[model samples]
Target: MKKLLFFFLLMPILIWSQSNFDKAEKLFQAKKYQEAQPLFEEVLKSKPLDIKTMDYLGEIEAHQKSWVKAAEYFKKLKELRPTTADYFYKYGGCLAMRAVEVNRLKALGMVGEMKESFEKAIILDPKHIPARWALIEIYLQLPGILGGSESKAISYSNQLAQLSSVDGYLSRGRIDVYFERYTLAEKNYIKAHEIGKSKITFQKLYNLYLNKLKDPKKARELKQKFES
Candidate 1:
């Protein structure tokens, strides 16, 4: 009777456990994210070495704004398979997001971590465009005194240029802005604007005019033009 009771007690748990993935996926598809998290987590606990599970869990954490946990999961993924660019890319991207919600020095430290992860991603897969863009953003934001230079940034950008035209022009403008060369930056940004019609292009121009170029008039013009 004890064995019979034990088997019955375990049946519900086993059935639910077996069906957890399907349940979680259904919830995820329905955007019932909170409902999905625990089941996916339970799956992870049992299958600790499953990289695909880790990737989905990391993505779910990202969607839930759990940046630190997401980064941790991605790091675990990298540890399991260090040569995968996707893992490093996700790790760097998560760290970058977490950095935004913290204090200055902490954010700076996260940026350093982000850069290292991005470099690793590039080393693993030189053609990973998203990883390339992450590196581009780092080189642009980091200070020259702290191992950040426009020249180095520009070189990386140039390598990216060969892959896509829009990316190329955008990168060139970024390099121009870094060196306080407003005219060149402006032209490249405008060209990017023409090709992509993306708000990012003009946004870059606005920052250059306001911060680097020290010309509020041009910045104001861009703001007015772009905002419309």
Candidate 2:
């Protein structure tokens, strides 16, 4: 009799929790993150092991630039879903931002972890363009003493090319700009432009002509195209 009574009492609570979860998810889908957060917290208070809710919370925190909090939530998500490449990538990105928010000494300690996490993501999903792009940027930004290498960055850019020709050309152009290889950068940018007429490609060519190459006539043409 007591067991039956307990089951009856628990059923309504479960139903209510599910209802709230549904509402919260609707709000989240609508991009009302601020409004959804409180409802998610309420659901979590009742069902602490809800991985999907946890993932949504992590995404909200990341979008808001709460890197440390985002890391905590994603770490938990990673524990729950160990083999997910996207989860590891999110965790790695959060940690990278947190590392930047800390002191140099603390940041140095985080570099290896961030790199390993991104590498793990890539290894798990080789066609993951975002992870590949992250690694490329990391290689380009770090100093030589801290594992930065232009050659390695170029290698990844080549891999990106294999995945997407436009991205490959754009990545190579950006890297060339970083190295002051303006002529090469312009050629690659032109190739990318030929491939597609995206605002990004136009902007890159426009900036190159206006700022680096000092070809105002060419820059104006690109600028007009972009505005149109």
Candidate 3:
């Protein structure tokens, strides 16, 4: 009789929690993060180990630029689900963004862990494209003394090419632009635009022509072609 009574008492709370979670999810999807956050927290109070709620909270914190708080949530997620690639990727991304705000020495100290996190994500899921792109940026941005290597960046770019030609060309174009190899960047961007024919690809090629190459005529032609 006591067990039956307890079950009846708990059922309403469970139903209420589920309803709140559903509502919170709708708000989150609508990008009303501020409104969704407190409801998600309420869900967490009822179900502390709720992975979806935790993930949503982490993303909200990240969107709000609360990097340390976001990192804490993602770090917990990675610990809770070690084999999940996206958790590790998000954790690394949070750390990287936090590093940008700290002192250089502190930031440098964070580099190894950031690299390790992204690498671990890749190891867990070989087809993880974002992790590969993060690694490419890390290699390109780090100094040689800190293990920066254009060759390493190119290697990841090649891997991306195998998985996605558009990403491959875009990444190569980015690297070339970074090095001020404008002509080479132009070729890569053009290739990406030809393959993708999307807004992102078109913008990249157009920006390169207008800004770096100083060829407004080419940019105009490209823009006209893309619009038409």
Candidate 4:
């Protein structure tokens, strides 16, 4: 009789929790993050280890630019789900953003862990595109004395190409632009635009022409063609 009574009492709470979660998810999807956050917190209080709730909270914090708080959530997620590539990637991204806000020495100290996290994400999922892109940026931006290498960046770009031709061309264009090899960048971006023909690809080529190459005529022509 007591067991039956307990079950009946618990059922209402469970139903309410589920209902709140559903509503919170809807708000989150609608980008009403401010409204969704408190509800998510409420749900977390009831189900402390709920992965989806935790992940949502992490993303909300990240969107709000609360990097340290977001990092805590994602770090917990990575620890709880070690084999999940995306969790590691998100954790690394949070750390990288946090590094940018800190003192240079502190930021430098964070570099190894950031690299390791992204590398682990790649190792866990060989075809993970975002992780590869993150690695490419890291390699490109780091100084040679701190282990930066253009060759390393190119290798990841090659890998991206093998996985996605559009990404491959776009990344190569980025590398060329970084080195101020405007003509080379233009060729790569043009190839990417030809293959992808999307807004992003078109913007890449347009920006290169207008900003880097200082060819306003080419940029205008490209823009016209894209619009047409």
RMSD of each: 5.0, 2.1, 1.1, 1.1
Model 2 regions more than 4 Å off: 1-4, 210-216
The best candidate by lDDT is: 3
TM-score of 2: 0.89
Q: Which stretches of model 3 miss by more than 4 angstroms?
A: none
Which candidate would rank higher by TM-score, 2 or 3?
3
Q: Model 4, which residues run further than 4 Å from truth?
A: none
Report the lDDT tens digits of candidate 4 across residue range 1-228: 999999999998888888889999999999999999999999898888989999999999999999999999999999999999999999999999998899988988888999999999999999999998888988888889998899999999999999999999999999999999989999999999999999999999999888888999999999999999
TM-score of each: 0.73, 0.89, 0.96, 0.96
| C-alpha lDDT values of all predictions | 0.83, 0.89, 0.95, 0.94
lDDT of 1 at 11: 87
Ten-residue region with minimum lDDT total, candidate 2 = 128-137
Q: Residue 72 of model 2: what lDDT?
A: 92
Give the alpha carbon lDDT tens digit for every residue of 156-184 in model 1.
77787887777889888877776778799
Residue range 10-95, candidate 3, lDDT tens digits: 99989999999999999999999999999999999999988999999999999999999999999999999999999999999999
- Alpha carbon deviation, residue 111, candidate 4 (Å): 1.0
